[model samples]
Target: MKTYQDQIGNVLGLKKTPLRIVSLVPSQTELLVDLGLKDSIVGITKFCIHPSSLRKEKTIVGGTKTINTEKIKTLQPDIILCNKEENTKEIVEACLKIAPTHVSDIFTIDDVIELINQYGEIFDCVSKSSEILDDLTNKLTNFQQFIKGEKTIKVAYFIWKNPWMVAGNTTFINHLLELNNFENVFRDKERYPEVDITKRSSVDAILLSSEPYPFKEKHILELQKKLPNVKVILVDGEMFSWYGSRLLKAFEYFKTLRNSI
Candidate 1:
């Protein structure tokens, strides 16, 4: 058996290469497929909807936060893929009982690239992983050029609405916002801070995300009533948050979003 360390530096002692794998994160699941490991995946969460064919091919082991331990045990995966924020500690502990669990802690683009390289070593797909990394680098470079000379837009991104929460500092969403030259007004606050939108300060734009809570057109109109002059648009949550293979398409989306606003 050889040892492999995940992005979180958790050393996993396993065989030369894992045959059966379980993925708990949606973005990472898509990344695994793009890395040519689709055939090896035995279990995945219901949220791993990317590639569109995984649902018919793999065993559904429940959602990201709530996992079925029994189903996971039956799959007997040689390795389980998880994320620090996506999965709970209890789930990680339960997963360890069945197989080696590789937990990823992603916060920046560099971290995503590092995770790709780590997966390359863990899954014995170094060449394929390098190719994906190069592609992502090239896309991000072009995106950098696309955003040149664009004035920074101070914005507030809404992910949930019941209590009114925004993507705060030290989050992957905030990092992407900065990449697109959009300044997050709540950057001073911690992760996912709750706020009273009615009493909030001024911002150039208000972004409504399409996930976790599915902020829709009606919601946009409601926020518009409060801030009549501010630009409010529905943003693709995947492009802003999903930090795996989805990143390949995100830069283009950002370009379009910037142009539209």
Candidate 2:
């Protein structure tokens, strides 16, 4: 048997080729299903709601950060998939104690493509993964063309509401913003940080995400009132967060979003 590994800390040890797998990250869980590993996936987190039909068939382990160790052990996964950002270090350590685990840490488009290739190799679906990657690359290129020479709009992308946290420089959201000719106002911040409304006034736009906190249309009106000059838009969280096959469609979405802005 051979073993394979990726730069993002994901490792695939070929013993029996991972017949039963558990995916903790919602985005990665969806990616596995996209890669045609639906039957091989035995367990998923309660938060993995994409491909809604899988919700009925897959065993629910728990959330990404917290999992029922006993229940996961009972399912007896040959391989466990987790993400560094989505799952805590403690959770990954606990999962490793039960089975061979692969942890992925992604922050850029390149990292996402590499992850797709790695998953393809592990799941024996390289051609499909390559095709998906090609589609994503093309979309991204087109998005770049569409946004070329556009003024860099200063934008604050809020992920949470109460504490008012906005995506910072190091996150994938920040990268997407840059791709769309939008300069992240909080580039000085290392990660997602709780921001003050007064400080947020400088941005030209306020982007409210549809997940993590499910920012709704009403929230847009609320934010618009607070920041009258800034354009408030409801953005799809998956477009910025999924980092997999979903990225193929995200560029076109971003293009439409840019036009709307």
lDDT of each: 0.92, 0.86
> Over the stretch 1-261, how does candidate 1's per-residue lDDT look in tens digits?
988787777788987699999999999999999999999999999999998989999999999999999999898899999999999989988988899999999889999999999899889999999999999999999999888889999999999988999999999999999999999999999899998766667699999999888998999889888889889999999999999889999998898999999
Query: Which stretch of 10 consecutive residues in model 1 shows the poorest summed lDDT?
Result: 195-204
The RMSD of every model to the true structure, in order and in angstroms, is 0.9, 1.5
Per-residue CA lDDT of model 2 for 1-261, tens digit only, reads: 768775655565767677899999998988998888899999999988889988799999999889999989999999899988899989988998999888888889989988899888877889888888888888888877888877888888889989889999889889888888888989999888998866655788888988798999899888778778888889999998888878877988887888888
Question: Quick one: best lDDT, which candidate?
Answer: 1
Candidate 1 deviant stretches above 4 angstroms: none
Residue 159 in model 2: shift from native, Å?
Answer: 0.4
For candidate 2, the per-residue lDDT at 122 reads 79
> For residue 248, what is the lDDT in candidate 2?
78
Best by TM-score: 1
Error of 2 at 95 (Å): 0.6
Query: Each candidate's TM vs. the true structure?
Result: 0.98, 0.95
